[model samples]
Target: MTNTDPDIRRKAEEIIFGMWDTLTEDERKEISEHLTIEEFQKNEYIYKELEIPKCIKWLISGKVKICKSGVTGRDQILRTIVPSEIFSFRAYFANDDYLTSALSFGHSVVASVPMTIIDKLLHTNIQVCRKLIKQLAIELGKADSRTVSLTQKHIRGRLAESLITLKNSYGLEEDGYTLSIYLSREELANMSNMTTSNAIRTLSSFATDKIIAIDGRKIKLINEEELKRISENG
Candidate 1:
């Protein structure tokens, strides 16, 4: 993580303290002293399972996926981290090493906040502690929902839901039809909790039925209502 753009750091700083107007000048200075910015290349492994969690990461740009590997070497993508979201720090709070891995979806920027700073703030700064608790609860809720959706849904339903999730996360491209994120079929399958072959075949079926249009790694939703129905019925 070596991109040295000064403006990026400023943006990251703004994001961290943007909502904390109640912070005193001294507290803000302490925060500035602890925050560090890092960059990641496409497909870079940001953190791996069993690594000791040293800091919290706030994604400032691009995307990241938190996933775990199965005994058979298959990967299951648990969640995708969007800009302004935090990842890989719950283990730190829980006094355990990371249980999953984080990989860059592409070139990305992350602001590293040390555990010491978070601990200090949690004990001394009531506002920051409450904010952290609220944010973690929200993430836990989303994770539980996704767990149910991925496990109970059929392959087609899961795939449709994944497409819908991506749409909501990144929005549409300028074409107003294509998804903003372009992922390989294998990656899509992992995220959808299906085999790569099944994902490819289901996507082809969707294309045939006019549910979606596929162009290389890009996907365009042609019949979003029908896809939504499938997702709901699942």
Candidate 2:
């Protein structure tokens, strides 16, 4: 359902404000006027694979995962989205339907503006075009790095890298050790490109080695340096 609440619109505008200094007063006003906000429950699909792009989306709160369905009917996680990050626009730029689906990792709020609006801005704003190009380049670099890690890393290294990726993406709790985001073993397996049992076994091995501590879905890094070494050696 779409939310037209003024407060939500204001919050969305505020998040986008500092992202692009090239946005003119008029462009900002236009974006604010057309923005639509929506709330999604955990595990809900924000957009399905092969769907046409209608809007450029921003994560206002909570987390989202971009994933593609593998041949074996399992989904492989591509990337995780954090608050204030823009998503779902790559397909628009490519002139194709989405290759991967986006799912809410938890209860989430998202803000969107029509792609038509962004296209108009891009045509008239050189700075906006450059900024978007830079963002695309960064995303491409990350994709390349992940591809190498998943294809070449051992089970222990893959699991350790996944944990570190989660930590870097969402950070840790106030305790400074427990990861802020809690993911089930299945989700961890998908992110690491391994079987659920393999993921669990590797995690158990890490705990036995004093590399990490696990409590249900929560994982605390016990020896972050060792974990990094394993990831680097892989």
Candidate 3:
């Protein structure tokens, strides 16, 4: 949290204003003046589970995975966040520590806004408080849906849904099929709530059926309609 690059600052402001439009000129200026920009390398830990929240982070670019570790040290991915998304807000609002660990999937730039400033704004600004509540509600709904998808879906359906979710969250490349972000097979399994071997075999089956094409870590959707059908059926 030491950089002051103008481009990063501009993107941070854009994300804040886009999400919460009620900030006054003074409030905006105050935020801009106090914000700190930090760069994290791929696979870097942004925060660990049970750590106290120091700042609210807005991901300006790259991807981050929120995960929790089991007793055996296995990781379960809770959510993947992309640019313009805010993290650690829930912990700050609850006056508690982070429940999950956040890690950078790739080299990422994050804007760190002090919790003190956020708390002050929430106290004085009703609009900001309302926006935060709405955001939290939406996140909760998504979590519920994700839990159902992972627990109830079959192997094929679970993998397909995971791919669809990734595409929707990170978008597709210029080809309109390949995912913008590349994840390893193990990571995909973690996201899908399945074993890595099951994920790999299912992916192979999908490839054989021409539903998807895999090039190392990159997956290209070849039959999105069929994929969606399997997801919906299961």
Instruction: Go through the candidates in order and give each one's C-alpha lDDT.
Output: 0.88, 0.92, 0.90
Model 3 error, position 14 (Å): 2.1
Taking all chains together, the TM-score of candidate 2 against the true structure is 0.97
What lDDT would candidate 3 get against the real structure? Answer: 0.90
- lDDT, residue 72, candidate 1: 85
What does the lDDT read for residue 103 in candidate 2? 97
TM-score computed on alpha carbons, candidate 1? 0.96
lDDT of 2 at 24: 94
- Candidate structures ordered by TM-score, highest first: 2, 1, 3
Decoy 3 TM-score against native: 0.96
Ranking by lDDT: 2, 3, 1
- Top TM-score: which candidate number? 2
lDDT of 3 by residue, 1-234 (tens): 456789888888899878878989888888888888888888899999999998988999989999999676889998999899988889877888898999999989888888999888998789989988988999999999988998898999999998998999999999999999999999999988889999999999999999999999999999999999999987
Better of 2 and 3 by lDDT: 2
What's the residue-level lDDT of 168 in candidate 1? 90
What local lDDT score does residue 216 receive in model 3, on the 0 to 100 scale?
A: 98
